[model samples]
Target chain A: MSHGRRQKPKNLLMILMLSPYLLLLFFFGVLPLIMAIFNVPTKSPSNPNGGWHVIKIVLHDFRLVPAAWHVLGFMALFVPLMIFFVVAMSLMLDTDTAPWKKWVRLAYIVPACISGSVAVLLWYVLLEPTLSPFKGVMHFFGITQASQIWKTSNLTYILVFMAFLSLAGQWILIQFGSLQSISGEILEAARVDGCTQFQLATKIKLPLIRKYVIYMGVLVFAGGLQIFVEPQLLNSSVYHGIAQQWSFDQLSYSLAFDNGNFGEASALSLMLLVPSLIGALLVIFKTDMFEDVNFKSPKKLAKEAKKREAAAA
Target chain B: MSIDFDKKAPATPEAPRKKKRKISIGHYAVNGWLIFWAIFSVIPMLWLILAPSKTDRQVSYKNPLSFASFHGYIRAWKNLQDFNSGVLAHWVINSVTYNLAIVVFASVTASLAGFVISASRIRFKKTFLISTLIMMLVPPVALVIPLFIEMNKVNLIDNPLSVILISSLYPFGAFLSYIYYSNTIPPEIYESARLDGCSDFGLYTKIAFPLSHPLLALLAFFAFVGNWGNYFMPYIMLPSPEHYTLPVGLGALFFSTPAINPGNGATSVPILKPEIALAGILVAVPVMIVFLISQKRLIRGMLAGSIKE
Candidate 1:
């Protein structure tokens, strides 16, 4: 890639270098999205006439508001708790001030390694009234059936929040890694300046890792809106009446699987697509994630800078 | 690189020690919060290990964290195997094949493309890189509808090939590999190899492959856990019972058991409740093991590409 003079990358080399990535992206991403839009069928699979009856659906018709209510209901507790526990656990793990650091760090990270349904089912069983291992405690409070709590009210939201607590291990690890990258000198200075532990956490470390926090924030937004597995698996007698279509993902899933309406399902998928794309764009534009990478090398950029100065002379 | 407080070691005593430094109540308060939440995180896992060891009735009655008889774990395992003609066995095999395929194919393509883009001369590099980022950001759900149809059109439906082809393109893996290479594969190595008359393929095989173990392990474990955990794609793509993965199979088990949830469609097949708990353990243990083994390498790999930038 290096040359005496800087030049744009060659077209052939780009094709050779990036074709696998581009192909996968096309097949799995761009092409699929385009085909989803084109999934409009001329006839229903059951229709014998095979007549031109292009399917049409509206995003507003999906009852997005109700779905949004459930989504936000889950997210309200989920996102803030994610941020709180992640920061708390990561700060504790990163600092030398904690006891049994290794054991606690391992325990905190165990949830991240677990997949979604397993974690949900584990929690589901533990919290179930008749199946709960915590039955003694629930009985002490006159709550015999764990399902009774979620049955009468929307207490499943709390269950969903508790289930997501384990999943925070992934983000905490990411943030912890970022925190580890901060220079020790800066923290020592803050400590020496009579900063309390809370002040050290909020003022110095949090500010420096603001970009990562933003990164996790946007991702949390995306993930919260698209929640599926927990609701799908939890939609049974264990926690009866936790709405099946709790999120748009579950909505679109049922729309496809139940009604066999890929067209409407595609529409629902696209609905989720818009905000996710926006959030990603915000992260890209608002953060330095792409700052260190570009087509031109540092040497080439420096050479260009020198050339500009010489031309001015 | 991980930060060391060595710089603070030297500068500490020079400051006035007049202000008595005691571990404040706030520090202990923070630790208390950390310890509480840390246990909060651990309790579910501890429950998973302990719950299945109790009888279904005992589970509802006993202290959740207590160890019950080992008989419960054994009986649950047997019942899980006996369910649906031992379909959980088939799900395990399918999961292994699918995850192994993803780990191999995804890693190879990702690393090769990553190496070429980062080290070799390439045109429209910025465009390629941006597109990869865009591809990564597009939530996987958005692709499900079209991919479902696409696999059907290609006659790959109900086939493992459907899942394999769909997962073959790890865009994030490629991005990570690109970052690892751009940062680790020094320009001098490339120059020296070229001077020694190394061909492009040879340089990659001889030089790059050997040096990418950390990245490779990181990507492999990532692919393993991601593919292992994934429920949606396989759920939609594979309609047949035999093609179900552990997650999908476990979902089927949850919905099938009656005592576990009497309200869930009559639970046609009678399955003990603890069997469901045991199955959850079965579903989780593989990924847990992978994470533990590759934990250090994965952390270092992530930090290498991320923190430096």
Candidate 2:
């Protein structure tokens, strides 16, 4: 990569181009993170014992741990729903099945296309304990009283519904897009070799698009952790467990703004960053998934092509 | 142009290899499931629109499915505009101002950062790129603790500038910018510009920036929506009543509503709940309008990188 004398000006130009970005990273990215780590050690009002104390407190707090687990557990309930939607949508949109797949794509994409705020507002109306049709059904079956519809006990159902409403469209869109990427010719080849639609989908399409699902899963899981506006807005009035700073995010909010405990809020916020960083690293290191999901792995595909050509020759 | 169009168009065969086909029972099951889910997704929106018309008493007395009186809108509108002699207007303006500054700063900075790192022969491009990934992966809540400390150190707590500055370094926007710059721009174009003696900034401004219109539009739309709908950060940063964003304002409104708190409803107390429908509409309008305007850019950008494989 060394440059000759002619490359001197090019090198200078490159250095000039990178200067602004370097300065921004130094000032914003590098500086703040260092400040945060530094601040972590001080025995602030938020963490009297110090940074490690705050971490241990957050880790050991029975409330925080289970609340975090509740989020995960709630998300787990939707696993089957996501699988059902993703696989069903993919199969429907696959080239072999449909002549007019465009309309199907539109249906799957529209829910995600709507704004999150709108989705939440809409869900509020549908889920309001007194008015929801499901409440009536529950009451009829002696399963739920009107007073207990969306209270703390059943808050999990509301959170699951909120997650599903906001994200179902997004997952469908990702899965459909991944499906559209698989070449029709390959499906046709499978068909010519006597692979049924189910067989082709199960054996071929499923394996090919497994990376996309994994990518979506990790991304959605991360998103589920950051559930804020929906729970804050929907569960604020009804559910007591949904404290001002219920989860890490809500708690951080209360710490900073509500309680004016900036130091504690910051500590809580730092705690929230750990899982997100892990998700990001998973994305970065998940090279097996990197190219397939985004169509960015053409370099590997090209190598495979050249090897096959050389072998044939 | 024709070649690109031909490629862009789905290459559906003119006709199916087989004749008229019978729709499968499985297809019915699929449609049934989708339609059922669609109804589930849609009914709530319909309720948001319908709920605002009724008073809390009317709302609770009757089934929620029924639309309440038209008076609810008048009350909700009054609450928004006439409450505290029109504080809601200021709240809206403050949100707009805060979000506008954030969108402009975040988009420009992200684009510049991404373009420079992607296009330039930076000494530590890998490090810069990895940092962007790390920052993107770090949850906003994690940054809140550090941000709060820094804001307080500067005496910026409860300041609009604090909120704006905190949101300005949007890692997601930066990631999008990097993706657009690295994937959309061709290296040969940079080489050509270099051969023509274009300076680095000149090349970016004259060539790369102009070519990145699609991404710029996409990022702008998303940046605005993210900042606009975001509640937790702004709720924490801007505590002043006048400076509240929509989400914060709505959260406060939700909290203050007495109708939600009337324990047992046996103890008679007039709980001041705004018409539920109108409140829903008010909270949702900013995002609804933005999505309607930018759906094209968003969908195009979304599908663009996807099809390249």
Q: What's the lDDT for all of these models?
A: 0.71, 0.62
Best by DockQ: 1
lDDT of 1 by residue, B1-309 (tens): 333312222145744344334555555766677777777776777788887788877776677678888888888888778788889899989988888888898988888888877777655666667767766666676677778867777789899988997898888788888888888889689779867867666667888889999778778877777788888889889989999988888877776667457665543344666777777777787777777665555555544444752
Model 2 CA lDDT for position B72:
78
Off by over 4 Å in 2: A1-30, A45-54, A78-84, A93-122, A133-144, A228-236, A240-246, A250-271, A292-313, B1-23, B54-75, B263-276, B292-309
Distance from true position, residue B197, model 1, in Å? 3.3
Q: Write the per-residue lDDT of candidate 2 for residues A243-288, one digit (tens) a residue.
A: 3444556655655556565545555666666677787788667745
Shift of residue A231 alpha carbon in model 2, Å: 4.4
Docking level of model 2: acceptable
RMSD of 1: 4.0
Off by over 4 Å in 1: A1-18, A40-56, A60-62, A95-99, A133-142, A152-156, A159-163, A236-241, A295-313, B1-11, B14-22, B264-270, B297-304
